[model samples]
Target chain A: MAAISVELFAYPWDILEATPERFLDHCVALGVTRAHVTVSYHSGKFLLPRNRSVRVYFPEPGALYFQPDAAAWAGGLAQPVSRLAGSGWLERLARGAAERSIELSAWAVFFHNSALGAAYPDLAVQNAFGDVYPFALCPSHEAVRDHAAALCRSVAALGIFSGVDLETIGYLGYFHGHHHEVTAIPLGMAEKFLLSLCFCPACRAACGSAGVDAESLAAAVRGLLDRRMQSDDASGGQDEEAEHVATLLVACPALAALIRLRMETVTALVKRLSVEAGSAKLAAFTSSFVGSPSNIWMEGVSPTDVGELVECFHLLAYAPDVAQVNSELVFFLALTSDPARVNLTLNLGLPLTTSFSQAAAKVEYALRQGVRRFSFFNYGFLGEARLRWIGDLARIARGDSR
Target chain B: MTELRAGVIGHGYTGKLHASAWLANPHAALTAVADSDASRLAGLPAGVRGYSAYEQLLADDLDAVSICLPTHLHAEATLEALARGKHVLLEKPIADNLRDARRMLMAAKAKGLTFYVGMTHRFYPELREAKAQIDAGAIGEIVAANDCVLEHLGFLNVPQWYLEKKFAGGGAALTSGVHLVDRLRWFLGDDVRAVAGRAGNSYFGADVEDSGQMFLYFRSGLSAQITFAFMREEHPLVCDLQVIGTRGSLTVHTWQSYELWNNSGRQRKVFYTQEPHPAKVQAGIAGEVEEFRASIVEGRTPWPSAEESTRAVQAILAYYESAATGRLIEIGDLHAV
Candidate 1:
């Protein structure tokens, strides 16, 4: 098998709290050559079980971990920077990574910012019911798209990054995590798709420009969704996801056309961001929350389309065993033109992986299938044992079992 | 209402227990029942109308219904009955999810019907006595607790629907585990601030978990460990609760017995049941039925109100969420989805 390149996903708090030298040295020893460090991200209650201090870390909502040039925000959304970032933590970490020859890539999350959405409610994704999902920014808006591009340009302008990992560049759905959220209603794939469909003014105008009747589509979604909500319909199973989407598309061709427009919108935005990333390799991740590589169109992401635009397409193989990982890989790889461009990103710890053998088997299988790149998710969440597992995995990937 | 007319839906195991409870309650009349299977409806008592479809039974005049349907059917059947202005005594874990449970509660409230979630385990003699002792300061300054239930009542022998998450919400965690969780919430108060759990289908190879474990942290500086396993018959069946307090401690085995002890470990009190397990369980169900009937007649909220039951459901759902994400989930973050 060919040797593989390994990347470790990390956050600024993980490195700053644990000290960058120790964190980066640990990554280098584990055979990680690149660190996809979080630069700009959304809010979440993250558990840092392996951190030297701080068991739980709540990130500043939609804050940039690095200083942004004022010129980048001239005509875009406000840039919220973390207190630590303003205090030069990002610069310190960048220096540490450069000293170790570890390529530091900027991982920026766009459009999934509750802070920006809250600041500009009109730019947030408005569902069919006219309810604003302040957690997700509507990508169809010119300002939101400009802000994302600006984010890329600013991170690239920092001149310390090798690549930019663009996440959530498309639309975030209704099921996006909100604080104390209670969506206990079992929603099927079709129902979720309808609920996720953005009807914001910009989205409506985009559809309208494409000769699709936006109002009628919104009415249809509202009616179908209302019936499902008011009635006692049991949710459809995962196996029925394709069937559900197919049936909905067959019944509502306008929705199908509208979805096509959404995919186009996301693809166009990614292309623009790639251009904005001056000489830095632009990478796009598969849909994390809303959909997978197979049905990412629901999140307005056509995997093959976006896969063509970026240097790497990172697919989250967050499954328990080799079979599930294989299935996710098979489905994702089938959709792309070049399988080598796909990087398999797996979680190093539980709920996704438990043992080195289980994780290694997935890596070996991916290697045998011509995938020579892997990314281990989250340096902060894993403990010593799982960290060692990643080290073993790196050796296995390099054809040196010892 | 001098006498409440009662109907029992779903003639399964819980359905039969509910039917017997309605018949045994003096203030309630067992008037009708519905079951999907004709064989289950064969032995309906004289003058008690039987229908294969619950809808037909709902059309009949009834003041209340003992909705012993499967977890998935709970929302639909209860909502229909509530729409007809009938009181609902829904079986535990209220519904498959919180949204349906909330809807059922709202429908009952809008119609001014008594909505009770039947948690028979709470009415178990030993458990009831344990609660009474704790309330009476027999166990002072409660500090910690553990609740565990292990039995062979899982995928192999139960209804097929119980194995599917779409039908059952979850396996052992939401099914039998919810009872222990509910009892803990009742004993310690609804102060579960966060939960961390582990669940899986280690046995039976079913889609849902056959065994589950949860660590709950209460806001009152108390913590609890809750475990449930729907294991093989060879595994000794145990339904146990042990609570530790500053002054004393107590242990209770549902339907069997309980023991209390002082700080020095001297046995202060002990109570054991001579009755068989099945009979004691039936008696507990009967007690809940009587409570439901009294609540309707006296226009009072039942012992375990809809909100309380929703809390149990929320806790179980949070446990499931924690298990899936492998993270500590705050109970406050739980909402209907």
Candidate 2:
């Protein structure tokens, strides 16, 4: 495992708005030694924009990408918006960071590109009914794979980025943060999972080559989802999502092979990106929203084989309860190569409804789970008090003060 | 923002209640309060400024306003607050009439202010979990619903206008029934196709109804039968919702949740929050207000937007129309033009 100290997630806008010196000063004051800044990001309509030049809705493709000399890539731009003409943004940060001694980590968002997906809709993920979700780029597509490798190289070229935090580099799922999204069709989580299963040409061909009957499975899935939507039965127990998967797998034994194939695709993509990184360490950013037990399989981004290639697993443990946080760490660690390489991120505000003591306890439990390093979510999003709580946890993590 | 400055309007029962909530909320402070009756406004905790009129309260800087006024004044207070570019957490039954509700929504939108409709159910942990799971499509597609909230009105301590139709709107249905009505539309869908009801004042004799039986048809092929009454026994508050879906069924109450399916055995999940009534009420207000504060600071939309709350008001209005004409009222008739 690569050695890492206390880190705080940040944004370039945060640096530009607060000015690099002031932002670095704030980091120093908070006792943070590193900043994982987003280079490529998505377009968002924030609540109070222009007033405060900080925070974003969600992480999207953030950094510029290089067309690797080895791959034949025709995709215009992998990311939707360009920071444009370098903005001398990375250079300025590197200069500012050099003075403050704050190590910079490029937070790279690989997929979930509205811009690229919209342009090459065929490269985007296709649902069971053949509905193309342009927001999610299919990992099977050569362009996406090529773009990912290029992205890693581009961030490493920034000179200031000492490490890389990889986000959404694998399969994009049904879950998205598109505001005001109307779920007109009440699709169950399992049904949505079925829909997220890419029946696109690439996925189908791969499944066929692997001896899995992709065509019949897709039909069966479509029929199952349609029937469930029409059934409206209320007696389903707590394990309905599990039940749905079990029932489907029983009907088509080949479905398990399809899932295994997905894991291989994502693993290969990461390995290629890891090779492209040269010396920069890769940290897999994994969060299943709220303690989803089967998130790795559901998203098809298992961190087992890539442990040697990747630096650390940046696990998101946002739940308030210490037990829940422990459970999340246990689940991630059981699958991860080295438990010590896991860097757990805890929520300090907004989504967290627990007290500061409870939040501190979550950090304590995560540390007990053999997680060596720790990082809070983006410094700009949380309230000042939560930021203070981060300082308190820093103290608590070291067992220096209560 | 570290903390939010909030004020409560109308020193009615809930007004005093939510003011204390704001004070107790870690993210909020009860900076100012307004009540028409000075006597009602008396005995407030220290440091909270007082006002006789809501307009005076609006003059002061406020991030959000919790309108605890009567049903009649809900629209005016909310409008006054929104017009001043303040976020609002108006209590249920956003307005007495749909017109005022629309006006308030438009004003809030024009200013880009968040309007959070305060529902007590939002505070219940188990209820919120059920709502989230339902939103995630756990129980296939909804086909039928059964919901009821029965309580004795005499035990409900409030101002005198509650007995008057003009001030409180209708009695049992508007006050207590709106909670379940909002929950149904929220958990089900806002596209309530039809509504029919029969209500009476025989129990309380307050000129407003004490018992209400309302039936609602949803566009998602789900029909809900809701019953609300003012029970005097005080045995306990009976509030539960049972939703039937194609693949499964779920019965959710404040304290318990149960899921049942065709071939599977029923599973019951019970959570006990056995605090006293006053403590529960205080917690509910504080939880909602804290959430409202967080929404403002975090730049996120509040749960169940004002537009969604309007559907609750719309359903109640349909129920009234049905009771008046002794016929089913199509929900489309209540749609704002």
Candidate 3:
């Protein structure tokens, strides 16, 4: 008498705006008992009318759905922008889901308000160097959390979705360590590379409360750097081999503590928010290079840590959309397409299932792996081909279809 | 009765700059240069001894020290120097974060040692002139200010420590944009009340941001916009400031060129004759050194004290909070932490 559980990726807003009847019928046809819907895109609506004649105004005025406590909504409400051709679309989509007996989990990408960044220059992240990254919002800002929570509440109030899935919470990169060719290192090793922790008051206070000696840590780092440079010089400076080893010695524990503290803070915040929501379950989709055995450049995380995170988030309760397992091969190939590295090339081109299937099967084979809760990147591929895999995956997850 | 001797910590770019500045200044004498990199100290100018460990450097008979190490090291080095009864000149962004910044400030204050933040931009002749003019009511009451700092990604490729979250802190905002934010806060003559910002790693793939934008709302009702990026092809280290007021507006280019526009008359005046900061490089070092010297001798307080820098730190943190949450974060919210 167990429920036949199946999770589907549904773009309800887009579907309703495009083909209301077909979208409704498709949900029924797939026997989709549950749907993970994308409530907000990076810039807004994903599927806009193909009419070249339609002029789209960003921040579509009253179109933005906010939580009750959202202070930023005052500005949004005051300005009346055009709604995506279809208004009151969520109600119709919810009705369709209800008719088909499908559960919907409203999914949103938090800390990314690309539209707001463009419309209001004040709401963007500025680097110390004075470059404004338009899409990302400050994680520590109350307004960001409040606004996001407001949006989630609005979606939940519709009586359509079962819960909300907050996708991609702490996904950020520094230009120096992540993008710059010279300083850029593998994602696994990146934690050890940066020269400063955010001296921003919030992070500093958080670190201090966590019993971290930010100054001592910095001093230790400087000491390590000094030692490394000396070692490098002694070794003829031809290679940074000695320096790398020295840095590793000093950086590992420091970086680990820093990351652990940050993760704890973030996890606690998310958990607190979820508790406040009463019924909603919070989930974070995190990308890690530590999943791969070949990620030797950086200290790989212990399997225990992985298990702890899984248990903490209760990931098993909800179906995963696409868990992209990255490794040395993927990172290497993505960085450069050198023919000399055939293994990396092959892995990059291979499917996520192939790259991680063995390890994934060993760990939790029945669980939905490499599955996305909400489609953020590569929507077209995910919508057409990936969803089929996801459906089959849901059936397998339920121990039925396979 | 005795001349003040100082040592330079971490002979990197900033360290070397500090060492050279010390050698050039009369009030302070370069006693020792301590760096782990023996090769980096190979060609030290005459009369300066290079030590492998900071302990050895601290043992030297020095009245003060300039910490030109990484952002994370500023607090530790400065604290050690201060604990040794040495006045300190710590580099900008103060400490890696606010807690460390406060600790450094408190430590220095407790010891009655002169501790000054190396906010070099404040020493720029143009900014100084601009500040003076604004204070004199030449530009009238400040209404708004905007700063854009764009540079090539080449600078992002420093040591790995420059990118690590533990060391460098947050990406562009902490490393490069801090200068702009501090300058804006200084020029506005008020503290940043609230902030909304966005940051991400779209460029290289590090966990920190390569490009970011921040909005700062000063307590004085003056708002400022700052953009920090490593995406540009050219390394254009431009700190262009546009200060608007009810009477007129002033645009500063290169911190030297000044253009003033009278709002009522709709007339513009371009002044290209003013000389740039004469002791620009030495200004921060000299001012900090003089303060340290005076504090050690005359028992006076330093300018741009650690407490003042804390406000700047809070402003940056507010921006980060806004960036992470995609909402307006008040300065009080940041201080609450």
Candidate 4:
């Protein structure tokens, strides 16, 4: 089975911009095979800060963040932003990393966009209730899907990257972590899910083609969420919500059809994107969601058939407690329909979500499950004291104490 | 001035709703009504007369008429009423097609009749105060506005005509989005220069779109995002409108109330809430009918004059055109006198 042996997430700005030789030397000493460099990052405004020392691995060429595209709406042919300003960083780093036999990968972030979504609202995700969540672009729309594919092709076309780590491809829920996001009204988990449901005509037509009455399904969800919103019962008990949702799903066939179709929508997107990415390994970034096995695959989670196109499923095991990691790991092990394609991505530090010991233990656990790869969350985020943990993680994964 | 006799020309659900508003208008007497649907016509009051053809109602002592028929027939009825020297209060869009809307407008102009398009949203008590506040520069300089009015078709009992391309014009946008478009135009008091919209009949599976996202660009450098759908059921109808200004942002959320919050989390506010639900159809129709009657009485155009209504229709039609062509369509192409 194809697998990523060992990888380290890096930022193009941090890893290869100032000192390419020193970065590669660190990689060589740590025994890492690849550098998953962030090719794109989001901001509150359009266009990256101009005249940076390097190009900063910006949006694919002329894809100026949210530049009005005629193809943002569905139909005819999608016009992708084919412009790329040359920084020569990818080429330079790839050449330098090749000297040490280390591969370069574009760690691409798709869908999440504040600038484009703000300037061009047509491309954002709208809920069933018509609230446009400017933080994201609905993958069901051909505009966003095409843009994402074009982004991958652009990065892959550079020929510097051996692989691409696809992150945030699925639906994002209530907590978008926006600045000063005070949702004054209380929204239950199900209410948020209902709000996230996209009944956009393109999505509906897809469901219609699948013989599901998308209209009734949307109505059922709307009705459920409306009842929840009106009823002052603020019981946020996790298990009860799950049971209630299960009961609601069983009661409403249309809602179930919609749920099934949402899964299909996400899978179809990955397949299309994976196909668009020519000559590059496409690894999907799964969330740190801890749940009973089936929950792992919800909200555009890859179904079993996705393995046919995707190279690897990168599961983000970003839990702090070792016990929580082990619990989810067991479920993930039993839950994975395809074991050969799964790899564990442990977070070293981000808002201190996970400790070094926990990350190491999770890596050990994944290795025990016959996994051959380990990709760290990132480099440059950790301070000097915490950053030393990367050396230990690499050495431990590589089976070298020194 | 003998209670300028008024008649409702369509007895469908909307036509019936218009009838109640007409009756509630003390200045206008509900003298007669017309509908091809005999059963719907049979539900009229005892003193109220009924006619199989709306033309026959225009032939009566009617001083004014409400064109609430199938959208395809709205123009015919409106032109007929205007030609017969009767003032007219037309339901949305003027007509299903541009040619018909133009004819009706010209007829109303030639007759010098009060031509009022039923933009009931403008009459919402909270919306009125909100508009006053914005006009009074309560939120300071305008930055951008994001408004949405999403509802569900499953609960709609939507008539067949609503799905018919010939009768309904487009779909949900034509039927419902005009309210939001009209409101935005009124709020900003600026003409829409261009539009970029992405719309589709995603869920309802009809010729008319049930969902859409519209970007309205104003000539004054102001912008607004409008999302309208007929696709929500359990959740309350989404009427979340946020107006961001340089000083602060005013948000009227979930049909309950409006508040102003600064870019910083500090200085939050809570405006007093208005009840009876903003989505309730009966909430503001009485005020709309009164506006129509007063316009007739005062011999002037309505607050949102017929031309303004034309602009709203033109902008939304451009939205559909934009969605269709995948181009930012100019609202000028469709805007006509």
Candidate 3 global lDDT: 0.54
Error of 1 at B325 (Å): 54
Instruction: State the C-alpha lDDT per candidate.
Output: 0.81, 0.71, 0.54, 0.68
TM-score for each of the candidates: 0.54, 0.51, 0.43, 0.48
DockQ for all candidate structures vs. native: 0.01, 0.01, 0.01, 0.01
Model 2 bad stretches (over 4 Å)? A1-4, A47-78, A81-86, A184-186, A234-240, A289-294, B1-337
Q: Which ten residues in a row have the lowest lDDT in candidate 4 chain B?
A: B271-280
**How are the candidates ranked when ordered by lDDT, highest leading?**
1, 2, 4, 3
Q: What DockQ class does candidate 2 belong to? A: incorrect
- Docking category of candidate 1: incorrect
- What are the per-residue Cα lDDT tens digits for candidate 4 across A300-381? 5654545456777776777677777677666665655555666667766655354667677877876777777777766545
Displacement of residue A276 (Cα, Å) in model 4 is 2.3
In model 3, the Cα lDDT at residue B267 comes to: 35
TM value for model 3? 0.43
Candidate 4 residue-wise lDDT, B168-208, digit = tens: 88888888888888888988889999999998877767887
Model 3, residue A70: distance off in Å is 76
Model 4 stretches astray by more than 4 angstroms = A1-4, A44-85, A237-240, A288-296, A337-339, A350-354, B1-337
RMSD of 1: 27.2
Q: What CAPRI class is candidate 3?
A: incorrect
lDDT of 3 at A78: 21
